[model samples]
Target: MDLDLSSAKLTQKKKNSEGINTQILRSICVKTYRTNITKHHIDVGDARPITLPPYRIWSPKTDYITQGLVHLKEQNIIEPATGPWAAPVTLQPKRDRTMRFCIDYRRLNEVTVRYVYLLPRIEDTLDALHDAEYFSTLDLRSGFWQVELDEESKEKTAFVTHDGLFQFTVMSFGLTNAPATFQRLMNVILSGLKWRCCLVYLDDVIIVSSAFDQHLKDINDV
Candidate 1:
């Protein structure tokens, strides 16, 4: 996965010959991407285990679910689970008509301890960009999956599938405190640069600048 922001927009650009240097930006982005592939670890905090029956998926969809679980195991993203917690797996259709493997963690989320780290308010985020002329937005691929779950927290993310029970070693979607955890990680990664040159809301990072040269440098710093 590349770290280059999904899209870089020259919003309301002032006419100038100094356009962005793609080669320099791409080089910096690749370096940043390599540095943070599995940098964040998620701690689910203290919670009692709740074993819930697997949700009934359509009979035809079971095969896809099985394959999905196996794929995750192959990548070491998940492992065989034998813990007290068991959530149900379900398949959601993607825009491309592929199955999106999902785990229903409503019961587990209800009992899990919440993270107090505050997410940035929308108004505040917008306010920070009031004076910016150039903007670049960066998105992390598989944002939640990029973060690993701590050993004790992994079992709490267990999900039952037709093949067997499994738990995600990396943070999975649908956890209650996921947003807070991810936001916290992003904040830490962009501490000094945040608000000064860029703004972060969870996995979405925005680098703002009034000049093109400065914007490129800001992206490098992020």
Candidate 2:
């Protein structure tokens, strides 16, 4: 049977510590499940397709993304949110906006500018991993935003003119060379360790082991 807490009206009525804790856990779990699913079922349908969200399109300019979507549609990786396949058009609100194309890469993925920033070489990182038997990989979610830059670097991130415009709090996806910068940071962190048996990917850690105790040590290091 389906559970409907809304009808129960039992919220905020719990008196004991255990009851309150249970209620809190239940609410948090429900919210996380709903938010991660999609825009439709959680907000509109109470989990029914009959109330699907408005049809939308995503116009990502990057070829890696575009081709991935096309492959997914053909191979049935996931169902499209919309009813049919149609060519994407620019979003002009006055033009009877029915579709939502995912663009506007600036703040969502911050703007970039020309620069000679030093990024650590990937080969050096690979060589440094020659002896370790375990690796613990952790990635800063919004790594670029973690380090502070001078006022000069701030200007490099700004987009453009006519109106006073644009800045970013997080490291955006489309910045020209941000990937290299992130890899560089990873290299730097790994360089300090003497073990030759570690493998670190952005957030995924892979540990190679000839022994059990070493694995625990690797886990502890991370």
TM-score of each: 0.81, 0.37
Give the whole-model CA lDDT for all candidates, comma-separated: 0.75, 0.37
Residue 157 miss distance in model 1 (angstroms): 0.8
Off by over 4 Å in 2: 1-139, 159-164, 202-204
Best by TM-score: 1
Compute the lDDT of residue 216 as modeled in candidate 1. 72
Local accuracy of candidate 1 as per-residue lDDT tens digits, 1-222? 333433444344422312344554455445212224333343445655688887878898788887887777777789988989898887889999988878888887777767788888999988888889888777766677777777767888888888888888887788888888788778777889999998988878888998877877886677
Top-lDDT structure, candidate number = 1
**What tens digits encode model 2's per-residue C-alpha lDDT throughout 1-222?**
123345432333322223433454355334211111111100111221221122234434334344544543453322333221112222323356433222243331222333354553468666676665433343333444333333323323332211112333233344555555544555566664423455555433354444545644544453
Model 1 clashing-pair count: 0
